[model samples]
Target: MDRIVRGLALSTITSSVVMAGGYKIPEQSLNSMALSAAYVAHTSGADTAYFNPANMAFMHGGKRYVEGGITLAHLPSNEFQSLPAYSGESEVEDIPIPFLHYVSEAMGDFRWGVSLVVPGGLTKRWTTPVQKAIAEEFTLKVIELNPSISYKVSDHFSVGGGVRLIYSEGVVKSNSADAYNQQLALADIARDMEGDTFELGYNLALAYKPTSDINLAVTYRSNIDLDEEGTATLYGGGDQLYHDDASVSVPLPAALNLAVSKTWNDTFTLEFNYERTFWSAYKALDFEYTGTGIVLTPFDDPIAKDWKDTNTFRVGATIEMANKITAMMGFAIDETPVPEETIGFELPDSDAKVFSMGFRYQQSEDLSWGAAFLYDSKESRSIKGMGTFHEGGAFLTTVGVAYEY
Candidate 1:
């Protein structure tokens, strides 16, 4: 009885803000906000291993370089929803993710790189004493690893490609009594799900330099899926486990980048970049619980997302100070990919605008330090489901550092 309700509350809260868009591919956004334009500028060092691998051919110095950083973002929501049968309102848990990249420039005309990214992972827990009856808590984790290679087509044009491997796991708990008595007990069973899967895919990146002050770049990441085959453990006074081959396919949308930059002088530069996310590929998040010898089909609904593609625009400026210190600032408007009909407690997505700032300082000829901060204002989101409606907003912050040799 207790486990069933706890699972619902947990699942609802954990997936709310971060997975709000359902298909989140913002791993690159996790970096220092000042470097928002750096992907095309190739401004930093090995971080390019994840943003744009072809940039490796453009690297001037060492044959090999490694870059890594951690990001912590907080979601403080102001509005929430609660059912009479349930105990309290729904709120998200804390979120923290880490990323690393490595690239080698030598090995003939070919450049190679590997990236471990937590791009679109999420964690949101909701456990209020009053709300513990309907749902207790939920947690979800996802990870991706990519290896790539880039070949220099010419001095002015370069192309790169790679493969992606993805892994995912989750836990859901709900109150048996609240769900059974209130007629919402389908997910009342407390269950733990764990699985791992790998997919093969590739990416293409192009950079054309018309002049030293002006350059054009574009990158495209292919789509992939995670066919997770695992078992679901239901533990109570005794551990009764359900073994099934459950599969969840999350599409990695394709994207297009168009950029233009100009250098005012050695001390100042400006950059503009536009990106389009083909989010329409992410129509629905379908989890097929492959029932075993026992025909254990719980519920069935049409699995179609009907998502629309979106575009993001960013403009930034960098000012070089004395002693190799560089100051930066930028603004960006991002559109939400989640459609109104599909928006649910699992993902509460909304359109938002971001304001960011950061800096880089050269400590020595061989080493440098970078710091960046970003503030994402809350975007009002409304959800209509199960004869109920919810409206709310969310806030977030990101901080990071970079190193190069």
Candidate 2:
């Protein structure tokens, strides 16, 4: 049944930001967040290292740039109500996410850079009766190290690519007392194992500038399969009834972003981005158990996901306000990959409209500090057979410093 899918799927929610759009977090940095991830074709600083490495070639007389920051994400509680039966509320805790980027000054025609970011993940918990039966808590944490290089083909064109090294870990848990039987009562989970793993992927990009005031770009990130292998234990009557080594694998999905940006009068800039996510790679969640043991309950079943690919539209505008402060705002229409049948307790995700605002204070030609904020407004959905998801969203705040030489 799809019951087990909720447990396995919830384990896929790696972090607060990854909770967006089926585990993908587009806002990895301050400027990227402030611009609603529309900074790809209009990179202004070191953040180009990840969003558009090719644009690093256009930093203009700058030798090197570095930016570091953290995002504080406050996740709202999720309210669930089903016809003729279940109802409850669950919320993931607030999370603090950190990231860093560095782009080298061009030496000849080549520029190199590196980025440390959280690409995707899952985190959710439930204490209510209905969902607690199979999805008490599911958690995942992931980190990625991306290093890249760009080649300036000419004054107007550039190309770049990078290798992705991703590290991840996940856990799943669910238990109920006196739910199915009159005697057995138990609840708890403990584990650490070979499931902590590292995976690899790649990305490519192209940037074109028809004029110094116009920038256009496209980038593609390949999919990475996070296969976790570890020990799993199931309890009954306050004791361990099943114990064994287990394994499960899920995809991080591929994504493509295309953007066009224009600077007007050298003071105002606007950019529009179209992004596509390949989420159909996940059809089901199956758990494998090995050695002298048995799989039971949530771990013994396969859950169907049948997720589909989705798309998003984003636009951002930046205005240089005064001597040093540049203000910006962004808007996006984000689509959800999860289908109606698969939506469950672990993640109450849905299509969303996002609004963001922030500003950057340029301390000097070589130093700057900035802050940004965003509100994700998830659209409510009424399911025919499933529960009613009282749709909600998250608020994220970010602050950081950058330097160039």
List clashing residue pairs in candidate 2.
12-122, 13-121, 13-122, 13-123, 14-121, 14-122, 14-140, 63-105, 195-229
Q: Supply the TM-score for candidate 1.
A: 0.79
TM-score for each of the candidates: 0.79, 0.91
Choose the strongest candidate by lDDT: 2
Candidate 2, after superposition: displacement of residue 296 in Å?
3.0
> After superposition, which runs of candidate 2 have C-alpha atoms over 4 Å from their true positions?
1-20, 83-85, 181-194, 236-239
Cα lDDT of model 1 by residue, 325-369, tens digit: 888887777887877755544445577676777777777765556
Output the lDDT of residue 20, model 2. Answer: 30
Model 1 has how many clashing residue pairs? 22
